[model samples]
Target: MTRPQLTYRSWATALAALVTAAATALIGPAAPAQAAAVTFTNPLAEQRADPHVYRHTDGYYYLTATVPEYDRIVLRRATTLQGLATATERVIWRRHGSGEMGAHIWAPEIHFIDGRWYVYFAAGRTEDIWAIRPYVLESSAANPLDGPWVERGQLQPARSSFSLDATTFVHNGVRYLAWAEYAGSNSNIYLARAVNPWTYTGTPALIATPTYAWETRGYRVNEGPAVLIRNGRVFMTYSASATDASYAVGLLTAAAGSDLLNPASWSKRATPVLASDGRTGQWGPGHNSFTVAEDGSDVIVYHSRNYERYLGNGYDPLSDPNRRTRIQRVYWNADGTPNFGVPVPDGLTPVRLRSHDLPDRYLRHWEFRARLEPNVTNLADSQFRIVAGLSNASAISLESTNYPGYYLRHRNHQVWVERSDGSALFRQDATFTRRAGLADATKVSLESVNFPGQYVRHRDGLLYLEAVPDAAGRASATFALD
Candidate 1:
């Protein structure tokens, strides 16, 4: 007999009912079911730049980006984040043949506001392709993809000159619009209070500009503003420099309840929060937006090219078609600031293993040697893919992110990441059974499959497979996966 495949909605409903029934029988009231974890490979979509992902309250995720053609606005939707990889894209609107909205359509961002859908984008005229300005479209349809969109004309935030990349956010019952426009020769980020989705009421304030050396490389630019509010603070991230390998993300912050229109309320970080990393092979990671995962963890969505050099005929950045959309988890620091780690290499999403006993230390490989270290400079070296074991499907193996074919294995009671030799002994030596932490039941411990009494533990800042029969040994073996 064959069984029907279960959809995510049906499976989640069944799981919630089972948890509720069990809780009511044992305790007084039913408890809420926990959400399943989400993971996806790098380069979520190809030939997509300035990516924006918005999670709606109707149980779906909507995505839009700057397509290489720069002639139409497209949108896609999926129930799961990874499902957006192969989701069918629909073009909602196209550029005009001539006149105002006739050429160079770019950086379209979709937003749901006040029970309606709005799309803000930039375009140039037919006669002059470089005379770019921001524009808007409105739709009352419940689904944005199936829209009879009405053009609202150009958005004049101020005396606009070479303006683009418009993004909007609401705070304290008032909406605000932010975008990048030229003040003389320097492109700077500006903000203003919005009277409606497409119009602003007050003079735009200059929030950020290209001043530092990193922001002024190639060309002085500060564009693509995205906002995230959390922990009594508002974080505004914008891209800087030219749209090449020098492009990076800088941050501006202010108190959640403070006056957002005042330029003095915002503080700029001296260095970039996210940029190119040679170790991960991701170049020019910028123009980022934020969304929440299935498990309620914060996720950052951005675009980056795998290679540093332009693969097109000329040096024009617009000619490159490899700026693919990518997503990664956003980690928070102890002081409540966000830590956007380096762009992870292509593969299954990696996780960081934090030592339970020493909270600051994490499992990492240095020069192919396994050790527990703090403040690791190369974040890719500390990331690993916990996959099914090579020997047994029931066990697990830790695969290095940077070194694709390498895994953590124990030889003569010492743990090191080595290339698999594909032998039965090597498989068993690499595989481990995950068990409840012996020191803290809430955490996890890795027990050696071949050596029943031994576990992967840290001693003298190095990793080793040893017997964990004592309390100190158990503490050293426990870890918290992030």
Candidate 2:
């Protein structure tokens, strides 16, 4: 497996200090420290949509997305999420010349189940290309990349009408299939118990209908269902409306133990959970799939147009050019619902909050216990979102990615996770001024805006706010944002 390499550089004088620290680490019971990653840009890959990034248990990330031509399925694999950008892509399957899987292929999802691989995708016939239906392709190879896929034929729900976006999940040892189908006038999300990877049993139950204003804009549609099971709940998010700027993501959730086939057991959020953020220039963000970051944090993979305007011919939105693949970290709400933050700006370089003294350690909180631990194997907890403070837009506050809605606020000179109340002290304590480090121009040092001279640093494996010291102290406070 190939992983992204991180390079570390330090001042010649600090090299001796680091060498001494390394020698001490060698003699101790602790493992060698890993270098922190300093940079990665957004729009992970370009000109791809309806992305399904699956992080296999074997330590490789498999990404499959619909090419702009809508003619075939492409697969790419990388050891790191960012590495997927340059990972070699291969077209695994293409549309048949004049048969059922003939034209307008869309939304391909690759899944490994029951020791075999299967791809669930939507396709239409050349005779009636608009009459799209869901189909499956099966591969016998242990590795999906090494596949000579066999056609498992079309998956027909009882009605045999317009159906697409078929997704499968296992709950309580029973496999279930959820997808969008024509419920008379418009498309709506439906659910049915699946007998295996490629087929469903029993009748399909309608779970979500486009009734809200957000769902009905431009067109009444509910498609592209992606399921995420966490915190004793089953969360399923689906795309809605026309495939334009009005497109958005709506959510339906049910308890983990609930009878998934019963539509009454699920509840839909009143509003769209993820939508276009005009401020960020990411329009029509939907058709999202979830994967975990290398650090074990939840990552949301989806497609969005960089520009709002559609460049396609007046008739079909699929001809639009800008629906590129993008990914960002997913945070959980204080109430346990997944929080899909607004689609971030393109070319984004995300940073993790690290301590100056403990160069190998970053801030992480578990059960509200914030501490500094070197080489945190669970890297997601160590990451914090540095956003403008609630009370003061000019000042920045650090929010824990693992524990959402909790900001690092200092009370009595001790930093801890506190509910961001937008208060004067909360803002002041949480607010930090980021400046270039004195030791390295590219490195960063964060100083407390409220405490003035006191900088966030570590001493004896614990973090503290102390008055600035000499050159070595300043060097200890510098951190590289990855």
Candidate 3:
């Protein structure tokens, strides 16, 4: 007997009732079904949108998105999928002011190319951050952390009034660039070949358009185009409808060996591969990208607004709607097509894959509090190594020993003990767990690495503070109720 086919729209409502009934229909399961599924919407990071995730060859998954912070690009990488929230982050690069790069940058993508790394992003000039043109940044380092990112300058733009979400793909030894252009005669998902980064000799070909009823929800607009090639097929996934309730994802496909430029080559999938539903409790699940788990399981990463609708007056809960990041596992059908699972709710601990092992080598696994040795210090700009306020020459270096748990600090908010262990204490789901209160640490017993900053869990919220030891030469901490 053959299993029946299901459309993406009905798939979630169906799966949640059957395959995921334990996680969906029943909560705080009487039987606590196994804990694996995509991450529930992160309440802490929910105020964001346009989340992009990529797995680097270095055994780390790097994720970034539009955030309230405009000073620098925030990024984090972790060995495990769940550690992303508390992972170490570095402002790899930043724009000085509000000109071409001075204001409102969106949808930055970091791609590894030709033994080096390059980041492609959309930013508008200071006058209008939304004039939004695609730009590229290059870093020659083996890893992006040891920064010194070199601005490669604006990549070849679409020459239209607005274009963004630039992504590069190599096919048949030829490199191609795909993007969304709204300033042209018409707005659609377009592709062009670049013998190099800045030149495109042929005219752009339109692969997909917003004609389907689902695709034309609020506006006949489609943007944020990303392409994935699998099994001799080119799959172009693009965001359709407006950025609000109308937001959804549409798929375009073409024969692997067909002339990509041929207008008829690419066919719309007829329906959205993903969409939003108030019924499932996850609102606006669109603008997505894909990643592979440590053992190569397909993980879908996307941005979403929580049960919010309408951008109206007075403190809109969805006001900060770049959308927070969410992840879910996806499997291909028997024919090698994509199958996106339903969105997991907030606060639910995801089930770990049966094959995952505890990576405890660094003792980084448990989240802890920390304490810095009393010495000269310059906490800012210098990271963990601090210079004495009285003397610049004398600096103290310390590791982030705090286990990823809760840390109590003096009211001044500076200098306190944190976890020294490498592991994080709280679970990764975005739900703020208020189940058990934190157990205060002994006045002098601190276990985390000290100094620069320590990550502590509070009601499930991760925060950082200055480390201060008691005058009695003792460090203090709080044990996680986690």
Candidate 4:
């Protein structure tokens, strides 16, 4: 309800034009034009990881994502539902001591109960970063900006040794928590009634398991569970297989009156609900959380390894930060089930991509607060279009802007804190930097020539293209820009 206020600016002008063209297209990503997007607020950015957006009573939207470092929980609040995607963030909880939470704290969610705020997340024991489980912390303050978060302890279900990805939902007046855990033989998804919000009731129930050939990718995994109730039906969606590879998502359903504990009452859908678009080369596209669009549309936010398999095998860059986050809309199939098909075709927008009904923030950038000083021109004062080049910058140089002092900037992808003289190594806290290859200058254009049907804005910015699919590195858009 308390969404941020944003006014239209010049940066988003061209995007306003594209939306008109996008409206008249006869395709899935393309759609009939409705109303022009009026910029509101958006919070998710290039660095926020493992994002989970939650809607609360005050009408304000709250979001928390796993920082790439896996050490702290980053929280952002915005007035409008979509604004949370672009708002400034604050680190709410941090690791203390050495074991469990001291390292690898991930997937934190901020929830409001009775007047107080609480956040639930999973972290590994200090000694071993892999011995991870869910833990809760509470805040007494009205806003999460500043709070004394008291540790509420862990919610480990009985019998199951390994577990994580916990979330709570209130259905028909009863509140229950659902999560994914492995019980020795198989890594599957499960559900349980929360005695309260932080603990489970009785025994846990199995909602889904990895029985299919496709569900098992990196490891026998079925995790990241989010429960949804629509038109009197109970549904649970869980991420499947390894944290890497073509990460997939699956769904399970239970009738209104059926016992949630009865696996018989719940039936797993035969096919995967979400997966990677091989053509886009963005693999392992699972681990998702749902949020409502400004106009009540469903938005799916998940992370993916932008480039090919870069990590998990010693010194691979893929494991470090290349595993960026991405998002797309989820539509309903004729049967009424949420149809989260594969992602958009990399560069070009999805054929029928539902604009989050967000303000004009999409297809635009306006964060540049520093005034552009008029530079000495090489071409006698000609005005140039500030276009997105081989990466993600919205830069304007007088053609002479190519030089160090008159450099182009993509704020999101800019490597913060680089060496003063533009060396490879620099401090970590720096805010902006000149994009790579800006000096080398590769042509930035529509990627239609590279992949045909799909068109990409090969802008000049920090897009860590993939190496696995071999050709995936060229002419595509990834979350590094998201």
Candidate 5:
């Protein structure tokens, strides 16, 4: 089904209903839903926007963002996602005092290319703050956080106009650059072939124009283009509308081998793929980047304002200081399009449990029935918040994402989704303890709390509580979290 478009006029009324839905919709079942004790929570850093995070091959997660001050560029490195909250930051570069790049620094992205590190950022001059342009910085130091940065000059497009949020990626052996540009009275996304580290080889192609109602909500915009290439497709996501509660994300897709330079080769989705969810306290979420987690799962890093209203008295929504840097898992649909489930709420983290025997299928309930189906697509439905159960803190309850109040429960040796009744039988029946998998140490087996020795197993394409009597039973009982 197509998602509904968000409009600025209905912000107040929509937010009210969203808050109610969030209060009851737990991302997972009630209990120890947190995957680990040391895991991180959302709103990763306050007053940080246009966030870019990358997991470096050197074994560290490096992050850079536009500071609230907008006067200098800063960098942070952490060994883990949660550790970034307290990781020390260093001022890498400062805005020029009185000329080009003198003020309004915004949307800085760090990339490691050709054995050296570079930072692509947007800035405006002190005299003309709206004449924003893209610039590049080079760091010869092996560690981007270790030394001095050299100015590599501005990245001028074929046409000298207002441009920002420039990102570069290589596809099919060619390098390409994408950014947002001022087109007529609105902003639209444009693409160019990169000649080298700093300039476009030819004229920038007008790739996407904001024509839909969602893209033209408060303002006609299609900025902050972020690219993800997967499943034989090149998916580019851009932020639309105004940077307020009305702000959202729109998607453009093209075949992996298509001519990216041709504007007609790409197609835009009719609706905003990601937008503000008042229930989750994430408003105007956009300007996103992609990364990989420690377990090699796809992760999305973006900035969002927690509150809906504009704090500034002026008409400029860009002055809003509530945009906080955040991160979450990115899932894919069966048709290969990305399914970014709602930006998870602030507290406990969510996880996906994949069957050990059927590696392609993650455990998901269909109409309160548990079964092993291949290529399970919808992320929200497949994800079960695993929290410590009510009966025992160590035991966990599996909550369904689509059916918020329902949990995975076993009855008469069969596993199924049932509503939580807050009873002894319900608590005992819903809770499960993680045990070592019979097949290997890397996988795990879930044992029912009430049914002692019996483990939750997948047999003959169905789930049931049973004893592992043979190799097939052991394999069927094991699972992995991705």
Candidate 6:
């Protein structure tokens, strides 16, 4: 015990321990790993309606939408989704002078089919502008922007009556086309199998109609069908009501392997998946297309008017040029269905906080009380902006996205999103110092600035400021800013 033998292994172990301790002492505790912030400005592009963002395998995002002029099919490509905002738009194909494809060029969705590029769009004649029909344009060029788009004529469904907003997808070795067509006096979504990009092989089946009260607002309408296949299910989102502020998004779902041409295969939701959020000043948020983000996360690309009123080109909502293109991340429910959430405000996008220990749960506010919940139906309740502290500039605060002026403040040790009464106590209660996660340094922990040793932790599904003195308590305090 007085004199230990200097073995090579023992000496190396002692030396390694001394080096680690010295390094730790020199730098204090290891700095926490900072997560890369993923954000994009709202209104991705101005005056772009029925926006479709397609991420190609060639590492480019191709964007095509309804131009305000309704005169041409324009295409823009960028490497990043955010870059699409400033990306140069090229009019790949223009309307015909007077015949078919002459007027009302709308909802141009770009898709790469087989080996050629295809643009499925709706157009009308100059003499009869209301005679809108879905059409297809093909290109042999590698880049659709630099295209010699050959008009493939109309993509004739089985019952093509004033058809528009056509979208195509292939599943189980079969390609199917989904579009909104006028059925009876109302516009309904129809589905059919496609032999080629321009032709349907079988009879088109009516999948969704404007029957619910939300679907029948200004008009008995259901149009703008967009297809997204995920989680063993085929999701079809279509726009309802008129093109005014009453326009919203409804969803129809079918089993992936089921007979898509059969009307019985699809089930429609009673309510819309996405609608206008007056709190965020977004109106008529409809005509959406889905795409994957750079990080391989699902993103919804849609058009919305920031203002509720239409003041451009008479009373027609379509005449208003302010229905700008926007995009946001799509969250998923426990059942694998998508939660589009509310149309977020026009600024930096908000983020969700996922519980570290309970991965399925998120920090959400219900009736103004902060708690952890899974599969939150109200998507806005789960979203928040991590901003500078209301009281201390050096700290941080969680601001509710839906309630602009409210923040997550600890009142009597319980967290709630309360309107700031402009009191010093309110600000102090809302402020929290961002610390390295007590359980996992890579994650984050919010410590109460007012109550130094207490941390914002989850207990019994509710959030509270409590002392994280144990491993379980530390785990509850940690959160992933997703």
What is candidate 2's lDDT per residue for 1-482, written digit by digit as tens?
A: 12321122124224434433432332222222222332234577667899998887778889998887889998989898877776778989999899688998999998888877889899999898987888999998877888999988788543378888988888888888888998777899998888777778888889889889999877899999999999999999999998888889999999998888888988999898888877567889999899887656788899998877542457456777558888887756546788775776664334465665555676666556567776564545566666665555655667765455677777777667777785687878887776666456556666789888877665555556777578767865676554
Q: Candidate 6: where are CA atoms >4 Å away? A: 1-37, 157-160, 310-314, 392-395, 449-453
Name the 10 consecutive residues with the lowest summed lDDT in model 5: 29-38
C-alpha positional error of residue 6 in candidate 1 after TM-score superposition, expressed in Å: 29
**Using alpha carbons, what is the TM-score of model 2?**
0.71
Which is better, 1 or 4, measured by TM-score? 1
In model 1, the runs with Cα more than 4 Å from the true position are 1-37, 157-159, 310-313, 355-361, 364-381, 387-395, 401-407, 411-444, 449-452, 459-462, 470-476
Can you write out model 5's per-residue Cα lDDT over 360-447, one digit (the tens) per residue?
A: 8777777777877776655666766666675776567776655666788898888898888988998888888877666765666888
Q: How well does candidate 2 score on lDDT at residue 239?
A: 94
lDDT tens digits, residues 317-345, model 3? 32354476777665454466765534544
Candidates 5 and 6: which is better by TM-score?
6
- Regions of candidate 3 where Cα sits further than 4 Å from its true position: 1-45, 69-71, 184-186, 197-199, 311-322, 348-482
The top-ranked prediction according to lDDT is: 6
RMSD of each: 7.5, 11.1, 19.7, 16.5, 8.2, 13.7
TM-score of each: 0.84, 0.71, 0.61, 0.63, 0.83, 0.87
Structure candidate 2, residue pairs in collision:
38-482, 356-476, 356-477
* Tens digits of lDDT, candidate 4, 286-372: 667777755566777777665455226564332455454455555554456676655533322231211121111112211322111
lDDT of each: 0.83, 0.75, 0.53, 0.53, 0.78, 0.84
* lDDT, candidate 1, at 28: 19
* Residue 456 CA displacement from its true place in model 1, Å: 1.6
Residue 380, model 3, lDDT: 14
Q: For all candidates, what are the clash counts?
A: 0, 3, 64, 48, 8, 0
